[model samples]
Target: MEKWDVVVVGAGPGGSYAAKTAAELGLKTVFFERGRRPGDKNSSGCGLGQRWWRDFPEIMEALQGLPSVRKVEMVVINLVDENNRLRYRCGTTGSDLCANRWPHGMDGISIYRRDLDPFLADLAVKAGAELRTSTLVSDVIMENGQVKGVRTEKGEPVYAQVVIAADGAMSTMARKSGIRNRWGGGCTLVPQLDFSADPDKMDDVIGNAEWVWFGALYGAYQVNFRDGFHIGAGQWLREDWDEKPTDMVKKVLQFPAFQAMCRAIDAKPREYQAHLLPWLKKPPKTYTGGMMLVGDAAGFPCPLEAEGIWHALTSGKIAAETAAWAISRGDTSERALSEYERRWKASPLGKEHEFGPEFVDLWNSTIFDPKLMARQIQLLLEFSMLHPFSVVFDWGDAHMDCFNQHLEHLLDLAPQFADFGRTYLAPLARGIWPKNVKRILLSVKPRIPVLGKLPDNTFLRLVAKLSKSLAPYLDPAVNQEAPLPREVFERSRKG
Candidate 1:
């Protein structure tokens, strides 16, 4: 048996970081990469978040020399329907589409996995950790319910004081060590298409901003780097996948604007790949006996963005810290390693998941379905991002037509808001709210009209009043009586 202080499985971002941190902490560290090299198994590329720039300065220093690095301060988002009709467009760094209070502004880095992994692995090697590329950890070595280390596919056993499993989302080590069984709903499948674009044309057309297309293919996105761009889409995995990810990627490429953009930039697809990523809606068991799981194996992806590099990096370092502490104390049992979960939860790594449930609702809602999302996006545009611009520009009859349609939609949605009160607010009022007042409010949730909760006659009157207020400024070309309150009531009653 070969013995070491720490054995880090899988040379992904989390595994490399664990090896790096463990070695820096004076532990005998070794990381295993099943691929020929660190980045070989990863999808082509994706964006790395603030944690890479702000939290890990050493990694930043290591990344400085790489050509694959492209730092961005803006992002472009497009919402399109199945008909190839563009529904809405927004940009993070745009001038006042809607006001926000982000202190850091929008900032991130786009890099290929091929570029990121090798350098990150090299950082660990530089910190005096051993690198074992092409080494597959087939199972973990356990003795009397305690993880002793890992066993290679070759059946060579490597013993260590602590084992950190950072393998991909479907981690064999995690299952073999009894941390978690295989997943059905806890992960997503992402299919990627890698393209080499004309660099100059890419800068001209794509620029430095990442482009996200929602509804055209929900969770569909593209990020530009030095010489190429990557397009990908993802959805949660079910036991029997209703939609094939490869088929979805092909359809995404067929989308009118996406295909046109490819033609403009002279893009050529060089690779098509797909992989599983963790998408945990609830907290996961990350530690057991002498083993700690980090990154994908531990389910640390962001709820909204579904990005995991930040979580991986942060959790990997924290897991290593726990390993170091436990090893020094000579207690490598489950009790000692449980601190790994504690430290992560106490850190931003865990707090980032606070809105997991809410976001997961959006992830599965009609908000991601192209046709249904189009209707919702129309509402969002009418009320928010597009409102200010419509105010300044005289878009003529088109604008008035939209105003009328939006009023109708708003009227349609009023009842749904009442349902919201019933589903969400009513139950909560039972606990914290006063009984009499709670009756007025408990009174709420699920799905009822927004104003439908009000005395029936009083509803939609607000919209008519607003229309009357704006009636004077409008030209005769626009119909002021379209959304009249009495007319709306008559329509509803007739139905």
Candidate 2:
């Protein structure tokens, strides 16, 4: 029996990052991957958030060297009617739109997992962690009610002081360890297809932009890489739903806008992949005994955007730090490992999960309805396409009357809007005051010429100091329990 300081299941972003950190700390770490190599089985709409550069400079430096990665400068939201006619289109670029929303001053990078995962795993190996590919981890070995190690399908027991489960949403280790019994109603299935085109053609067509399409049969997104595009559609699934995610993918491809985009690029389909993406209503119990879960295993994907890479990397680093601390103290007990959960909850990763259920419910009830969304998009198009000068001077009264009529139509859907406000909007607004304040400050700072030229580090330090100063008041408001909007609405109706 070979003993190691840490054993990580799955060589995805989380597992690789954990291994890298543990190994760098002089801990003997081993990461296992069932795939022939890291990322062989992974699929995503493939946007790596800018937070990675802020948190792990070394990783960002390495990623910059990859030829396949492309910086995303803009994000376009498109809405098309059932007839596949474009109803609304909006695009935003520059610091005002992207940097204010992101913690870092850049949007994100688009990269395929086939390149990213292997690169991350190699980084871990370079940091002195051992990588074992084509190895399936069947179960965690338990002794005296503590996780002792992992047993491979080949019946070999690899012992470790601590085990990090990063085996993704359908985590075998988490289920077998009894940490998670079943997925929640918010679980989504995303079917994705990768297409390759001429690099110049892709750049010309997409212009370093990502596209998100609503008012379609399903929610679809597209990311443009250096020479290819990753496109996918996502839908929340009930346990009883029989239709495959591929069917939804096909439906999305049928949209005229999607078809036109594909035709414009003359994209040749390279691959098709689907994944089970988990969106937990709340954070799950992430640690027990000598075991800690990170990434999708612990349901760390962002509820609003379903962005997994940032959460995966952040949680992986946190788990590794906690494991290292526990090892140094010679206490791998459940109580000691519980610190991982506490520390994560204090971080941004935990805060993002706070409103997960509300976001899911709101989207399912409102934005997910294609007909309602299409109507709203149609009205938005009507408003946007009108010449501003004509509206103000030539047809002022008539245009105003038309706008008021559209408003009335939208108001008729007030029940749905009310449901959203109560369930999602109000709670999110209450919880994110600190974040909103930060965004406002960031937005305002760029207008001061001297202040705008300050280095990224200086700006970040100032932001951190401001956040720390406000934590005393803001933390309580964010964490305080509040009645659900639905409950309040029901009570009001009864009254």
Candidate 3:
């Protein structure tokens, strides 16, 4: 039996980050993982949000050219018939593609979870956290009606004043502790089929492009190309909870529309993996007597686009900070820990969960209606192709600062989303600009379109009417205060 200050379960980005932050903060941290090595059992399409570099610059520096870093700049949305023949298709740039806009015009790289996860874990070790892989936490240890520690499979007792569950979506600790009881219809099953091949053939075409296919019962169809060697389809689904990864890959490969998109780059399935994700929602509760949850266990999914890695890392950091603060105060009570939830919601972390439900409602409605989905995909394609410039951000020296300012602007829009009803232009502007440019665009954008369809006058009229209301927020002082880093912007432009 060993007593530690904080115990993090799971070694994914969320867990590793939590441990690293905790240890660096001088907390006695112990990380328990079920995998043989740090990243042994992991599988992911590995698309990260641009925010990754903002918080964990070290991870980005370490993984700059790793084998799993998948690059994407263009996304093509297509409708595949039952036989996998493509009936309709559209392509657009990473800059203006509103699907999952990046701030700062930054494009995401898909890294192998197998490599990336371990790298983060090793970094945590370097930061002075104890890493214990192959340690399965079988049950949580409680006393005085509060969580005090956990019991591993071999019956070893590891004690901690505060417990953070980064155990991922099917969190056994969460279920055991009564934190999460169920997942909503918003859960997305991302089934991916991975392929490894020659860099030239793969990188030249797949390197710059990613695709989403509509009409599949499982969810959205995605092709992510990584490091010019690994390519996979992250097929999304809101239903068919019973389908296995192998079957999902089989069905997707047979889809006529999916086949057509694959033909352009010559892709084939080499390996298959499955991931079940819960939608963004307020966890039933994040804090208990002496315990809390982070990452997937806490139910913070990437709100609008189902991106989880960034959110997971963000929540993990928040949880670690909360734990550190609580321990320093000699208090791990529910009241002290409540600060974690409050702070998370106060920042973009909270907004991510808030916007998740709306996405769920829209995706659910559209997933079942193939024709409707096709039409929406068509509109997206049309928008991407016709208005590629606005949708893409090619800023030379102003990339990073511009993006940060933009994100700050979007955060400003948070308080107004409820008052303006559906006329919110933030998403439309964001989806169209680089994530870094999104907030800035939102500040100036008057009419925000929802669901990709709006009357031309509808948005302009709303903007005109709201101009006076928005004048105070968009003062010149705000714009001139700071811009993104010029060097990164210039380099990105060159690249």
Candidate 4:
């Protein structure tokens, strides 16, 4: 039995970050993983914002030396008709309309997790943390209703003053700690399949960018990478998921878009692996009590977007600071660790965490419906085509209120907007547009700038006005609890 100041289980982003930060702060940290090597068990590609690396300057510096696929601009999103006969595409970003734009890069960066994950693990070692591979954490050690350490597969006890569970999704530790049960049906399980292709052909197919597909490819979404492409889909499971991932990929390729994506890459799906992705609705109140839960263990995955890598890394950093605070005080009490939650609330990612559930409901429902998905793409096209500048830059960066306002604006166009989403939008578009135009337009620029760009103050006011109009249709009770931003009541108001 070797006692340590902090023991971090799972060497993925969260675990490695916790170990690195704590060790750098002079704590004796031990990081463990079950994988044979850092990248062995990791996936191939992921879509994430570059802002995630803002806190870890060293990580960003290293990214400069790695191969990257820059998505400086994006074209319109595509939505398919049921028969796959008609396709619609539209330009959603300003890079397509304007030649020059500041920060001339993708809104986010896409990387092969194999390369990126291992790189991050190495950073922990450089920061003074000892990382052990092939070590599995099977259970946690608890005494007097408090956690003390963890039990390993080798039957060894790795004791620590404090333990941080950065285990990825499907965390056995989280369940043992009673933080959460098996995730609910609302959680989306995504299986990713990676395929290799010729560099030139891959370049031509991917073309310096990436795109997300919804309600197509058998209603499964897809993303492409530089050396290859990723194909798979996710759905809310009402029961425990026991199906092999390879089978799921076969089922997903049945979708027309998935087929097209596979053909474009000039490859066949020979293999697949499954990773559990959890959608966390809120931060757990009691993630620490001599033990802390971060990353997917705490259900930090964004419920709405199905993206958790950034959240995992961010929480891991905060958990590290809080762990240090505990060690310096020579106490690992729940009260002391509360700073973890407090600091989290102050961070940008924390602010977004609060609305996870709301976002999840909206996205899952809207995205699952093919007709609604297509109309949404069409709506974006209509707006972006008309007001390229306003639609492009400002609309995206505006405050939450402005986005909510636009939602209301779209709702007003059709009285029963939410209710008649797919059932109406599909028929309406098919009936309204000439078949030829629809076919040609699907590949053209999509997205709209109807929300009108203005200075911050004026834009906020516009959002408030639209929110008021939505009051009649929305549930007053829920609105009151997490009040939608009104003109007079801004979520972030400065004096």
Model 2: worst 10 consecutive residues (lDDT sum): 471-480
Better of 1 and 4 by TM-score: 1
lDDT of each residue in 1-495, candidate 1, tens digit only: 689999999999999999999999999999999999999999888787655656886676567568887766678887766576665677776444222323333456799999999888998999999999998889888899999989999999999999999997988988999988977587888888899988889888888788987653455788888788988888777665577778777766767888888899999998989888877776589999989999988889897788888788888999999999999999999998889888997787766775566566656654345455655555444445335565446454587676676567667776765664465344232122122332342345224566546652243344334454322212223333332233333343344
Kindly report which residue pairs in candidate 2 clash with one another. Answer: none
True-vs-predicted CA distance for residue 55, candidate 3, Å:
2.4
Which ranges in model 3 have alpha carbons more than 4 Å from their true place?
A: 79-88, 94-104, 184-186, 216-218, 223-248, 255-268, 368-495
TM-scores for candidates 1 onward, in order: 0.80, 0.82, 0.72, 0.74
lDDT of 3 by residue, 1-495 (tens): 699999999998899999999999999999999999877776644666556666666677668678766666557666654445565566764434544443435555666777789888988899999999999888788787678888899999899989989888888888777666767554556666676555565666555566665544444546464532332333345455445556645655667554554565566557766777766534557777677888778777775566778878888888999999999999888778888888887777775554454455565445534445544444333333333353246364476665555456555654543333344333232222133333554445544447125453354445435564333223333233233223333343344
- Summed backbone clashes in each candidate are 22, 0, 36, 19
lDDT of 1: 0.76
Q: What TM-score does prediction 4 earn?
A: 0.74
Model 1 / residue 219 / CA error / Å: 2.9
lDDT for each residue of candidate 2 in 336-394, tens digit (9 for 90 to 100): 99999999988988777767777776666545555556655555454454535434554
CA RMSD for every model?
A: 11.7, 8.4, 12.0, 11.0
Alpha carbon lDDT of each predicted model: 0.76, 0.78, 0.65, 0.65
Task: Give candidate 3's error at residue 239 in angstroms.
Answer: 8.6
RMSD of 3: 12.0
- What's the ranking of the predictions by TM-score, best on top? 2, 1, 4, 3
**Highest lDDT model number:** 2
